[model samples]
Target chain A: MTSTSLNNTVPAPQSTPSYADIQSIVANDFEVMDKQVFGSLNSKVQLVMSVSQHVINAGGKRMRPLITLLCARMFDDNPSEKAMHLAAITEMLHTATLVHDDVIDESGQRRGKPTANATWDNATAVLVGDYLIARAFNLLVGFQSLPLLQVFSDGTCDIAEGEVLQLQHQHNPAATEEDYLRIIDGKTSRLFMMATQGAAILQDKTEYMTALGDFGQHFGNAFQIIDDVLDYSGDSEVMGKNLGDDLAEGKPTLPTIKALELLKDSDTEGYEQLRIAVQTGKTPNAEQLIELVRSSGSLAYCKQRALEETKLAQDALSTLPDNRYRTGLYQLTELASARLV
Target chain B: MTSTSLNNTVPAPQSTPSYADIQSIVANDFEVMDKQVFGSLNSKVQLVMSVSQHVINAGGKRMRPLITLLCARMFDDNPSEKAMHLAAITEMLHTATLVHDDVIDESGQRRGKPTANATWDNATAVLVGDYLIARAFNLLVGFQSLPLLQVFSDGTCDIAEGEVLQLQHQHNPAATEEDYLRIIDGKTSRLFMMATQGAAILQDKTEYMTALGDFGQHFGNAFQIIDDVLDYSGDSEVMGKNLGDDLAEGKPTLPTIKALELLKDSDTEGYEQLRIAVQTGKTPNAEQLIELVRSSGSLAYCKQRALEETKLAQDALSTLPDNRYRTGLYQLTELASARLV
Candidate 1:
């Protein structure tokens, strides 16, 4: 629910550069960052390490860390390992949220992998998630940057608040697009903002903070929006996604929120069915509800919104620097937007 | 399990001081600290506020923060408000752990109050708990003391690891008393250390840290031992505590661990019943098992160990200022040990 399933699995886009291409732009940094994500998890408790390593192994894309790597390179080609370390912290934080999200959603599997909750139990998942978050801050404090700690700590609060906000709106049919924006703003975009802005703070590139924030926020919004739209229209069978998982969880994502808005007057019975599905979370009519959302021109609206966010993200990046790293960020947004087409 | 039920309930002793008596020594700081605990919770999300306030409202005697206030005043009769602020943060961290503990335990009530998990649900409980944790760190960072942040971040990691250690040892009949000590050291005593040491750090009383640490550790150990001892021998019928709840949950507390050791050679059948109960977390013969542990002289041994720890805590206080605050600290340990009598 807190972008737990928002894996950076960019769908087919013949024109845009791929995720691997962007990651390769900072391939060396990514290698170090990937190792540090595992290395930084120093826990005497075997269960903490085992569960953390398992989840980090299955962690999707390392997308946020890659953003940090790219941003660091954008500022200084030979930025200190601090950027890589910070990138790793961002991934750890993201993984922590995902672990808790699985517990909350009672999700057995995520992105074709069994979740920590499935492998162990909700209690293990919850505690391990807590360890990851605590360890992240512990490592962040080692950097001796008050600003770094401030942003990370504040971002963490936003992430939790965003998650709670999503919970508040769960099973709520009246949740608005504004409410959806606010939710993603915290749960999803806030970390993305941290990934880039953290690198800026580390490299003494404080001047670029605002632009990096915009880039991270809009890009995050685009990524999450694309993921939510896929919950309805993606090749769920091939992806192994139980279609309408979000709706079944009564997660009033943008697709559901917008569909309810578009269909409020056009098709009262269809609207009523979708509304009840969200409110009750008894998605006996899951297929029909998904189809109703898909046909209500809601997916089109969401796709367009995702593109607008992508464009805004690219525009924000243009204000940062002109480099292969910046281009990589642009392509990353294009890759996210590519999923819709 | 992670000291979630260590409610700091000081049992009867006419000579030893009462909890209210010790708290009254720092009554002003306690009042300010209490308000800060509620005031510092500034989540804009209504649910975060609602759940956080509910849990904070239900938070027990706030034993840890009282340690902080006393430590601060012992160093400086009028220490800065930072001490009070840090005290509040400790309580916040404690409440956060309790909220998650309820979720992990699937507990409906804790200390005779409906838990956040029971009042709302696990999802809300979990995310709100996360928010409380993040919020605590967020406020801690406001202190601008890197060392303070370092200790807190490190303490938080230890807390989580302690909890995971508890979960790992759960349902294991082979768990040792040493393992029990390590579990409580992290889950229960670590925060106590933080409560005392954090105030010393704030007051620039660097010399007192070692003594404060010793005091916190021993007092915490004594407090937790008394609580576990009560599980087997306390008036469960009147206290609303279900006897053998720890055994039913397969928690390897000192009483169960010691009982297992004591009866293994002396009473094989009784030992096997306790062993099976621990391993399976099923106590069909709960009353008999509680009686066995009680009669095996395990509680007496535990009570003796608790008194020894209480003496060590009082000894630690002798190195610090010998004001009423120090007496408050000494009396606090005496009150805890008095429960054993």
Candidate 2:
């Protein structure tokens, strides 16, 4: 178990705990919520179960569900099991989006594991993705809480719209930072907000709804911006996807969008090269383009923007009750900004 | 407007009405419901709107909503606008499924119009289909009825499961009638049941739930069976796809499942040819195989099954009121059987 185990012998925090520290604080919830994720996939169809299990098992950090758990504890120390179940449902919804995103991205792997589309066919992946979505809603209805269903359903619509909006902007270099924000807001951040807001709704702590919403939205923005930045500059092995992937797909994330803007003013020839690459999605000179974005100083501007958003997210945490769970959320934003380094 | 308009003169049917006649019986509800289908696609993304509108416009006869409207009117002569809204959501969910289905089938056209996947790419189609689904649940939440949400969510899971189950059985020549029934129940009839049962719930007619379910399941079974049978024998010009499309995809529908069963006992050479064709999805001698199924009399057996299902659906209508609406439901089943002839 090492020093990281979520056991009875807990140490007092000297400072903001690490992301792993936040995870261990909620480790028991995380452990049970992880099982709930797989347990929720109770499809009678064997293929549905297997494919859903595959994608959920190829789990991301379960960050969205973690937000739910932290928010639940923030409101009241010993929250009901609904929050864990809702956290699982949040992750299930996130998994559904990832499965479809992989199909849309035509991705072979995620987090160094073969994606559902790669393991099975697109047809199976698409349908299983659908099952995950339906099952998520099915489980949400079990709470008998219309308010929870409301936020999740509304957020889900935004998620899909964000994805479609991103596709609409694909291969179009005219996309702006505003457009990039809108894209991430839907494709990435909506679920994050849902994660926190869902906990508030579940815990009957609706008074914290606004603060949780702000925290979720800002943190989500910061998290997604960092992720997009990582796509350009981070270690591909650690990221589980190659750098310049967004560029290869012609996705004009903030970094790319800013780089295009910065290059438009400073270097005319460089601007055309990047613009043509973005417009065409033909990245034959991939290394040069990656170098161009890295050298163009847009990453610096994006890093600044990410920090600003993180500060905003952390500020939102101040209005909520002060506890380790809130500290966990604050450290989460810090950890997100750390990825920028 | 001719005698067909829903303006006023909904004539009394002396016998089972025509499909169009039954359609005219609920023409007012159908008109509003049809608009609601397009109206419900409130996506902010232009691409989402365009693709969603494109597919919903290329709609079938709105039969599922028709069933809902009929069920609503049978319970109360004048149903609420909620029923109309619910009916529209039904079609929206149905459209979402069709969009995904086109992507899975790699279909070029549906109802002689370019499908979303054909007009846009699979990524756009898949995501837009996702938007349609999310939007459906989002709208369903407006009803504020837990029971309504329960049925729709559960049915959606079943619908996706059916699709996955069909995919699981694909290219398996050993698939049987039992397997085919299970697949169609999940894929085809589950939504049909939701359509009927959703109306009963909206109209506060829970007492009629079982009968409505039976009507939906049997009619869905009959509708799908006839459609699959048409793949073998119907006119390609009207159906808008080539004959043996399912066989080409290695989809073992009832005709194929039963034909494989019948051929094994009577004609060994014919059986091997059909079996290999299904197993490998290499339908080189397509006409020869189609004729082999026809000669095997699987269509005759399938038609009989369709009639029996149609009968069960009509018998379910008898448990509800005996108004023009119930009459409309009865004639819908009859019209479905007529396609067999």
Candidate 3:
């Protein structure tokens, strides 16, 4: 049940730059750019900035920002200074959404640590989230692109709508695959789309920009589905996450939903019991539940879908000229789907 | 100890139609305009619109949007369809702040009714607030003014920082007036400045736009100070709010902060008791405290400052051309200051 083969493969996914690879190219830039964007949090809003940076520094992949920078680097020889700013901004936006998400979920923990809301109270967390988001726009507006502003704003709206849709389905056992897809697209992928598309916009890659947006969107879907799958399949340390967090929150994630659909009437009662346990926020020793999902091929089903999305993401790269960076982006999609396998 | 004379003479101070009066001319226009702005909430994002309308209809004064529309009407004969859209956007941004404020305060009620957070849940309320803010930008980006987006974005950042300032001071008895003033200016007046200035930008009134922003900021400070006074000195019903709601939340409103500063050593016990009451979030018998504040003339002190700000607001208007709407704006400054007389 604990797939050693899958665990081994996660470290060498085809599409993703290994953490070391990303670091070699952009780590110092990430630090400097983040300081510039967040340094705007000065004497007046220092409290907000201090608390927010503390939260951000805790641990996050910086994947969104990296994707943005890589997308720009792919198109332009020496991507303008605006690329760094946009990269920092997309990360800020993503961070803001996470803080707000913690508040929405009433979550005390995130990424295996105490969330800002848990440590500083909901008011501080909420305000800090707002501050980060406002700062993101502040950085973006410095570039003076109405089209850029429009794209990011539309993305934020989609994110908010996705959050609300997820809220409506809390503890709802009947949450559909379609609903899950839309929610993840809005909540996670839209930001990914904005990040990639914003970079393309900066590079003046008008035609490729739209394609990059699609790529990010599809990659994001695959990324999130794998995340959901890992909620069942991942190691606490390896994933930097606690398993069953989604189920504990009654998230009705794809594997759980699919497993529920696949159950026989007699088995359905047992599944309902597990669902009840999830809804009530009791994990109920769900090893057998994981086995049920794996045995029923529900996990495989999700993997298949994730692979399809990864294909779509890779196909989006065809719009761009051949380059190492483009190949790197193509590899990210392969890496995302490979996580499930 | 109530100033019966000031209360009696309240309506004697202003003879002109205030900004509210000018704004009323286009109140229905705002309704139509809001519909058009929010109508963009597509089928996928309709949840954002429905919940947003619920919160909007929950009864706010529509002050910011009215300022926006009146400013546009004053500066130009044709304020562009874009201006109307931006006006609606301003109102939405203001409403988003209020909803988030209610969530942060954990106030079950707002505007004499249950808040969106209380009526639904914090999650719904938070997402809805984000949606509105995003929607405001979505509307503004259509006008294709990078400068306008910059203004709105900066105001929002200031607002977020201001809220954080207030959060840091909550329940801290030593919070100074300077701290209080800075917070209020950022949280409240900045948006008001942006609202008027954004309108002026549309009319291409560069000099007058800066003046209008100054006018709006000063007037907004006066308006909020008066509102704080009313929170203490006026009828809960007539003011259409819960009396001492600020006290219950331990908010260091003008009256309470002043009252606390004036306390003597023997009054230390009483002050501590009041502080405990504020911190514990219990409904104190505010009658004695109200009398104490009255005797100290803190209410009068705050009102004098309000009027001073109103004068500053009026003087700023001199920089603008003589227009009927501008006259109405000047009258509105007096109306804001006179609210708690």
TM-score of each: 0.95, 0.96, 0.91
Angstrom error at residue A334, model 2: 0.6
Clash pairs, model 1 backbone: none
Candidates' C-alpha lDDT: 0.90, 0.89, 0.76
lDDT of 1 by residue, A212-320 (tens): 9998999999999999999998887655578899999999999999999999999999999999999999988778888899999999999999989987887787666
Lowest summed lDDT across 10 adjacent residues in model 1 chain A is found at: A1-10
Model 2 lDDT tens row, B1-341: 22123212334446556778788877898899988888877777899989888888899888888889888988998888888999999999999999999999999998889999999899999999999999999999999999999999999999999999999999999998998999999989999999999998998989989988998999999999999999999999988889999999999999999998999989999999999999888998999999999999999999999988987776676667666787677677777787777
Per-residue lDDT of A1-341 in model 3, one digit per residue for the tens? 12233233234544555555654455556666667555645536667867887787864777888788778878885777788788878888888888998887788877778889888888888888888888787778888887788899888888888988887777877878988998999999999899888987887777876778778899999999888888888777877667777777878888888877776454866677666755675666667666676676678888888888887787777767566666666656665665765
User: Model 1, clash count?
Assistant: 0
Candidate 1 lDDT tens digits, B40-140: 98888999999999999998899999999998998999899999999999999999999999999989988888999999999999999999999999999
**Tens digit per residue, CA lDDT, model 3, B1-341:** 12233233234444655555766666666666667545645536555667776787775777777777778877775567766777778877888998899898887777777788888878888888888877777777878887788888889999998899987877766777888898889899999999899988887887776678778889888988888888778888777677677777777777777767776444786677666655665755777666666666678888888888887777777756556666556656766765665
Give the winner by DockQ: 1 or 3: 1
The TM-score obtained for chain B of candidate 1 when compared with the true chain B: 0.95
| Candidate 3, residue A34: how far the Cα is off, in Å | 4.4
lDDT of 2 at B116: 91
Q: Interface Cα RMSD for all candidates?
A: 0.5, 0.5, 1.5
**Model 1 regions lying over 4 Å from their true place:** A1-14, A237-240, B1-14, B237-240
Best by lDDT: 1
